[model samples]
Target: EMALASDIGVMVTTDPSQAYAEPLHAWLFGEDQGRYLIAVPEGGVDPILRAAAGTGVPVRRIGTTGGAVITVNGQGAVSVAELKALHENWLPVYMA
Candidate 1:
């Protein structure tokens, strides 16, 4: 439904664990054949922000192809440098 209607799909869920799963499924269905983007809020423990820290249930392992870009934000502002560094260092390795 969403894939048929939009050129891109943005899934914002409170549960980070579920975020990637659906995207991956959509990709399998050919809905995300190089036409979709999945973004998630930083998953960490911040008492005031109601974020989760570390790992537990609802968290699952998934492999990235490395070219995918990830962005991190704090209080609605992106941490540009940090995200860049992360992409540079991690993205290639994951994709390779």
Candidate 2:
């Protein structure tokens, strides 16, 4: 849990960011956890393209840091309860 574990910025997603990784993170951590950068799909790379271009690394701008909240595509804010439901539904493979 970055909220209690670290005192630095953490990269939140990877281009070709796999499956539920991005969604679960944005919902669980949000800005309240720390300053974070989420990688988006191909169309969302302009913000970090120049900065990361020469490094041979790809980056993108997906979510923005605002308040203590979880937002997906600037529309859905995954509530704590919703996050719990998500885990209950999706992560059952791990629980058993």
Candidate 3:
């Protein structure tokens, strides 16, 4: 729900294959520790890269943000409005 919380769209261009030499079973359903996705403002990523490099922390640009639809590899995953509705309606439904 990053898009919903940040009020921006996100497109995931990279997949598990990029980071893993072999296929990861259930990668979509599994959590890898210390992995993170961050949004950097346009034209502001160089510093972050430099810092990461200096600290020996691997980082890469994986996505871009804007628009209203969340997409992965150019395929629309979901819209912010739909997710927001789900988030807002979940509690009431659960309570009932």
* Highest-lDDT candidate: 3
C-alpha TM-scores of all predictions: 0.19, 0.33, 0.74
How high is the lDDT of residue 69 in model 2? 39
- lDDT of each residue in 1-96, candidate 1, tens digit only: 322233222222233444445553353345533344333334432431332223332332222212222222112333334455565679787888
Candidate with maximal TM-score = 3
User: How big is the positional error of residue 70 in model 2, measured in Å on the Cα after superposition?
Assistant: 0.5
Taken over the whole model, the C-alpha lDDT of each candidate is 0.35, 0.47, 0.77
Question: Cα deviation in Å at residue 73, candidate 3?
Answer: 0.8
Over 4 Å off, model 2: 1-48, 79-96
lDDT score, candidate 3, position 96: 100
Q: Model 3: which residue pairs collide?
A: none
How far is 14's C-alpha from truth in model 2 (Å)? Answer: 12
